[model samples]
Target: MTQQPLEPGQAPAEHPDAVPLYGPRYRENPAEIFSELRRTHGPVVPVLLEGDVFAWLVIGYRELHELMGDPQLFARDSRIWNQWPNIPPDWPLMTFVAYQPSILFGEGPDHQRRVDAMSGALSEVDQFELRARCEEVADALIDGFAGSGEAELMTQYVYSIPVMTVAWMMGISTTEIDGVARDAVAALDGGEGAPAAYGRLAATMQNLLAAKRAEPGPDVTSRMLAHPVALTDEELVPDLLLVALGGQEPTALWIGNTLHLMLTDDRFSLTLSGGRQSVGQALNEVLWENAPVQAGLGRWATRDTQLGGRHIQAGDALLLGLAGANADPYVRPTSGPPANNAHLSFAHGSHGCPHPAPEIAEVIARTAVEVLLDRIPDVILAVPAEELTWRPSFQLRGLLSLPVKFSPVPATRS
Candidate 1:
């Protein structure tokens, strides 16, 4: 199916603020739409994406939560692909198999079964081992650019960490992983972005699957092969790629955003190093205020239902505002700090992303922080926060470049 241009030019429309907030093509600051509708249309508002399909935009946290709780009513299955006429057959499959369920995108008994398999994989020993490996990778990557004083964090350090970690987890060798990782990132280029990246990822996974089948190793991909309900290479590659894309790109954005946010805000900076409790809270706030993913886990309405006073018909594709819902004042009473509100950065309910690769991820994130502290402790932004280039993406929002400056650390410390 050919994708309709939702917002062709993507500029603001003629109606002005009084009418529906419209953008020329794709949604710009969708959060703004949700915020505006919160006052005017209740929590849910009837919205059109690319100006074609009629979907509900869920702005409020409570309403979003309720919708996610019932998988049957708000399904996240094959129906979502039906709504996107743009996804061509050549599109790269997701990095991991999402359809068969893996903790991020599954339903019913199959969903539970996948969750159980993943839970076993997340044992304490496995986590500790991954952490050790991630720390080494983090140190090597960050150290290489530490002397430069200012580096493109996302491209240089952010994307590298997760890609390397996920690649290693899949049993891909370090020598070949860089090329595969680079191609994997490309697969996520949908629409105006690079479309063939997905295909490359699928191909690479296919090769890896064949290799593993002949001689399975101790990696996650190998364990997946041992599953009672094993998926074929063709079936698993796309979902695996999706997992890789979701795990890598969004994570890279989150890490970069966190650093940038903390650098600008004193409250966040103060609490960052105060152990897991403080760092955890700061991470929560960053995830809420500046998540890599802008839209919520998508769902296609199974039946006509009234949500937030809006008539949602069956087959309508709904875009829930994970960030907006997290910040919604009507949902939770945020008292002590900004981080206290329950956030949907990882999505929520049935399709929520399991903290897969949590230990490795945390080690990498913390090591990035440590590297900055050790190399350039007093680093400050060279430009205003607003001046930073936010990559124009509705699905993923992140800083394209963040310039900062500081005197280098002493020779001994460096």
Candidate 2:
């Protein structure tokens, strides 16, 4: 499931100890690999990405925190990467680093503008209404399989909730939400069909933009278009794409991973009797431990700098190892909840997930979990806890599937 060593030789990185960040070893479990990498190479480990492309993973909590705060030293623009020549145009991971005019690569003043506008629009979403909408989405999804007394929650349930909720928030009709959500998840998978899937998403957004521009509504798209910053349709399309993506995939994974934790971990077994609050608690714990986004495209070194005891050269890519940072032994306590919510799950700094985006995601995720538990109180893992397989993705921490069994239940009374 990997490619032959691309380039001059087997060793693609400057550090001799650089290890491939793919293959069976990593797919089995990345925590142990991150631990070993930290132990062997310190906080900043030199690693080879999917195609043996050299990059640095910042695993230390302190180093990652500093990088997020100091964008001057490590910028968001990935076009400065020195290894671009060796990377293929169709590299599966290119969606992360490719130079797009969107907010992902925005810098300084302009980036702040985009962040402000997006945050303003997201803040306008009524939390009460959003939670209600998410509950509806969850209940409808569960109704499809609740009668069978079983379901593979990942694709059937987990992936649909956030995408459908976000798509609805964009004012898409119910009929189109399913198809858009499917294509969006495909795009997020970054697989062979991702380009086409992403193209379809952009086209959908283009159509939405046209509709919103002509006649605005109280939805997210209309709010962004009506923002005083005066974003053109071009700017809105990509920003909307980021909203659909940033809002969908990670949030979906957040719910799925947390559900995985609740079903598999004994600590949460007691909450299965239709508890609602535990959903939020489990969501928080998941953020601290198995952050949905394990890493990011990360910042390019603005100039030669020393960090985590490693001398980094200019233009070197320093990926934010979110799961690694959250698990740093120096910061995380052994037997209790971490002292504070300092985990880098949503990232930090100005470029971090915009102000209200995290809140919106949590609402979507929490309600999805709560509604499912309320409807199917006795859901249990269909497979042994250890038998579940993690998705073969270094970027996202999610399961390939979450098979579960529950008693048959009639649809909601509402």
Candidate 3:
């Protein structure tokens, strides 16, 4: 089917070239496919997210930046979407795009109120303290596998560090951290029982909020409770869920992806081993190439519009192709290191990630990786890079497992 002009209130007709945004094809080697889509179909490619669901995937750097900044035109409030009523609850992407009372799903004044509550709470966090906690967690995790000399970093180290650290920061007891982390991951990767997983997460947050309400502590949850806005339990639960998942998942992926790059790419190896590139460089490179949230949550169009030469009807969804935009030829340099940290991995505009500054997140990731390398200086990938499998999800891009081998050492931490 040819690219024809679409009219207002009409869904973009499914073209023969409509790419499947999910499934194994996208889970593996998404960069190549996204690049081809941008090259062949321009920046805004119409894609089939799931059964009979279609949305425009914004791949161009300039286009995505513009779209993200214009909250009035492209809003995050799914309630305003005309097609929302028609979409089934079981649709795989609903876990992300479905209406929630969190800051992530709000716009305008309501969004600002949520943002203020989160920002005020997160502002009290000490990045140095957070990094120190991450190192301690990393050391503890490494101690678990120090003797074996063979371990899956994703499970043993990378994944656990962020979740545990974020939990600790949020004042969750060590006893409940694992369950919370598991439920949060399940909720984020929408699939069977996602609603139950989300329910469990909400229950966990509700408990945390109640605990904070009764006995306020120095943690983020308490701080948010203590904010001037005085968020209700309904509002607080979803915000806590957003903050916890946002704080942990992507940071974990960054650590894992950076470690993977250091093991597989010679440039990364040299950088980690005191070569020309730095750990920060490797981290930024990974952000550009493999953003943890490869595609951001959907934004609904408030009215009929044209973006990157494609007609978008009112209520049509537009997904910001973050990783694709980073790799776009027009904005991406053909050669050399990124001149500045301008990548949209954290997104842009008013609705971007509000808590845990990018610098702080980078510090947490870099500190964790550095501590691990300091302990096990000669770690190598046990399986080939190609053998590594990514978790199948439309929003998150992360490894299922990253096994590595190293010389055995005694546990140094108690």
Candidate 4:
């Protein structure tokens, strides 16, 4: 059944973490705040996170599962989103490139076509190949810090692998691709290192797209260019840039977050080391427990609809929480504790992130580390957990640094 539109004067639930989007509380402890709402307001609650505009906040996992998949009830478009006051200029550009029009963001036939085009080369066999390549990349990166006994896992390990793999797939030189990916992700929030980095990354993707047009290769960009979908130069360039840039950082962070959580939680650590299925289960736990995208999902109400019993009007921006939904007890009954089910790190429905492949890769990558740790009994945290600095961003989740020490078992005195 399609969800109904929101009605007027249905005030947002009063919660401490319920604040304007610009506030730090929104960035810092969104899940905590949303949890409060879920308890107080039930599954679907009213929210005003984006600005003063009201939209439905889908708190329960089941609601998100239904809402994200049902296009007739909920809609996404760059234009409908622009009406909100205080909307960022780059917001539309980023949304269009990163989410809307992208396969995950598209509705109806356009979504299917775009997905088919890009996914042809990303088959299960291709995914295996990507995993193999990622394994090699992971080896080289981990080796770089092997002798040091301590290294920033995010910069040196987590961030490097996906960017390199994506670049390799795209036929971009690893040297150029890694730096560009790093700079672009750093610039996402338009902060200190953001402006210059964003510019360079943007220019690089634009140039590469042009190059691909003239001489297409086996990469995703080449495939996209060959697709039947009509893509403007404006759309194609920034869109590819957004994909290449946005893809790697979150992946890297999730990997880091998983590792960080595993090392900290005894039960999680034991499960991850159990076996393949155990590791897979543990991976799901990590995704839910430490989801990288801390903020809720973003959407604009197309027209008035009654969702979760609240009245919402057209142009209402719904900032649904991915992490919140996954953790909700209603979604997955709390069996013993909060670690039973896989987290909603990827999201639900047609618009959910197409990251099962990468997520699998991330699990394998982190599990490999666990395997190594088991093999090497002396591996230990070289630095305090508090010393680790996580990347500061409302959109992405990851660590900035993870320094650890390992005392390798002495070479057997043969």
Candidate 5:
């Protein structure tokens, strides 16, 4: 059966009991709500994003996998979204869904061009050197707070390592790293002043691109400039921005979430307490249970279809719920150890994250956490874990702060 596209100027129908994806309730413990959603609505559930916009949320592992793999049927280019013109400029989701000339938002041959250029540039990065730099940064960050004995891990350690590492990869100078980090955070949060924040971030990338063109280095930007794809500055800038943002934010969140699991959950704590699970195994558990990216970008339907028993009209938007799909009871057993890379946290198919393979991300995260643990073996949460607050963003799942206490030790790095 075919479902007709909603006529222009007509409002999409609302699901009276549809869950809102962002709010204090959802942020506090999304897993619970996700489980309830799966039980009540099966795989494809209707959801309300900010601005009361309606979209289909794919929660079943198999359903999300099929949708991502069949990109021809479910396109990534937001330009084809039939109701984009009607969405307000200030709509909360505009920052994510609006058309951009980057690999992330393109489709078909255009997507191939952008991804090829991006993958080529990323391939030039020396993984061994990258890991060493990450370790050095992690040690230095830990050194800064080692003496204080009480620090917020998110701000002091987890967040800084990824940004500084990414800055170095892009050949951004020490002086400019702070500014770029601030703007990147603002842009990702999509809070008030997000537009201005995005402008500043773009301006920073533009300047970086110019400098790389003038004096090319071994950085990713220089490699991109030298690639045969020959992306012009306009094309080069957004892709650079995508790589930097994509590399930093999710990795930071992964580290923080993994640390949180080790500190709070007994199963992970047992692993840390000399049980069977290694840090890498614990990290995989986090990937399956509390993925950094809760939901993926919207994929527009190319033709009328039925998904998980719900009618989906052409041009309708669907969001792949990574965290929710990972929690789907069908694929993941409630009692067993998590299988490595079994979840859609990084997504799959043509739109999967091309750079920073999952293995590299794991190394970066594991190294950071291991360094902190080695330096402060007795580190524990300063307050009850339940009291910790989470960032209230639809796209990200991370803590705002993770205050920890440990015996003061001298700075590890001079």
Candidate 6:
């Protein structure tokens, strides 16, 4: 394969207010950047993703709401994107924008079938059983570092909870759980190894689908295999990939963000660090202020239309500005209390993370946080909060590490 040009004639230079959506400034302080963008460029601002990929970033609360809710105007399919012609074969965002048979890019009847299959399969996940599994995984993870007195919770605990539970839900045995988690992280992290990692995960899902076909069970894979609408192995595999990979990173970050908040903010610290008190509020607050998945790959315009006082041409891609919308004063002026989880953290409309998925994620996130705090009540930030660093990605907002210190504890097992 040959490399091609990188810039969209990169309009940031041409469109002065067109904010380049990458760089240390954006990564280090996205809120400040969003605030500045709202003040200077208003809600629907012209932006450049890395490689000078031009797209719309819909930051206004109502505007984002309308964009997501009204998919008729803004379609979910990326194949309609006008910018595809200019995108290089090796483009960094190819995985995000690439059209797939998966639910992520599906539209109309196809989208509905996939969503129904996914939602129905997810609905079969018995919450109580899932909780027990989570507690078991959480306990085992905590036991690993319990005697250390000091540990990096992100890698050891926060990250492990979701993947393992999701693995259990998918009927993956404990032996193969680590590889599933490892591959999911690498594939989504969008590095040089991402393509190969993605291939490995896809292959794993195919094998699972085959097994479920011959002998189904009480698992997400088997349930999807048994969905009424019926999906071919080709159709089912991508959605399975979605469930497997999707459940991990964001939920892990959600737990990490909530913990970071509980530790740093005195308002919730005393209660949150102690036990279950204020845990729910802390989680909700983090959803509004520090959404794990800050931005979604987004929607393409079906036809030319007006949005946020700007003309949007047909096929123009619009990145769903979830974090920005959550912060929008017009929609959620006061953030401390969730106005019924009105935040677009899970996105909305046809293409949003379907029912039971967000609930499931919240369960995993909340359980992870509560169990960790219960096990290590004395945990505190190993370094000053300001000294903590974040991974450099405009799409996901998460701490690179969550190093903490606590008193050494006797292993509950052995």
Superposed by TM-score, candidate 1 places the C-alpha of residue 400 at a distance from the truth, in angstroms, of 0.4
TM-score of each: 0.81, 0.95, 0.94, 0.79, 0.94, 0.95
What is candidate 2's lDDT per residue for 272-344, written digit by digit as tens? 8856867777899888878889887789998888999998888888889998998898898887657477788
* True-vs-predicted CA distance for residue 33, candidate 2, Å: 1.4
- lDDT tens digits, residue span 1-414, model 6: 112223565563435566787766756778887888899889998998777787899999899989988878898788888777688777766777888888988778888988999999899888888888888899999999999999998898888899889988998767777888888877777666777778898988998888778888899999988889989999988899899888988898899999889888888777754658778888888888899988877899988899998878788889988999888888665545454688889988888889999999988988888888888888888999999898877788888898999899888799
Which candidate's lDDT is highest? 2
Query: Candidate 5 residues 1-414, lDDT tens each?
Result: 334444433435545666677767867888888889998999998876775566789999889999999988998878767666567787656778888887777888888988888888777788889889988998888888899889999988898888898889889889988887778788788777677777888888899988988999998889888889888898988888887788788989999998998888886665553422467777888888778888866798988888888888788789988998988877776687467577888899999878555666776788888888778877889999889999876678899999999899888666
Between candidates 3 and 5, the lDDT winner: 3
- The per-candidate count of clashes, in order, stands at 23, 0, 0, 15, 0, 0
RMSD of each: 5.1, 3.3, 3.3, 5.3, 2.5, 3.0
The 10 consecutive residues of candidate 1 with the worst lDDT sum are 11-20
lDDT (Cα atoms) of all candidates against the true structure = 0.62, 0.85, 0.82, 0.59, 0.82, 0.84
- lDDT: worst 10-residue window of model 6: 1-10
Q: Which stretches of candidate 4 lie over 4 Å from their true place?
A: 1-18, 21-31, 45-56, 88-105, 187-200, 228-235, 268-278, 336-343, 355-377, 386-394, 408-414
Q: How big is the positional error of residue 59 in model 6, measured in Å on the Cα after superposition?
A: 0.7
The regions of model 2 sitting more than 4 angstroms off are 1-13
Model 4 scores a C-alpha lDDT of 0.59
Which sections of candidate 3 miss by over 4 Å?
Answer: 1-16, 271-277
**Pairs of colliding residues, candidate 5:** none
lDDT (0-100) at residue 121 of candidate 6?
A: 89
Between prediction 1 and prediction 3, the one with superior TM-score is 3
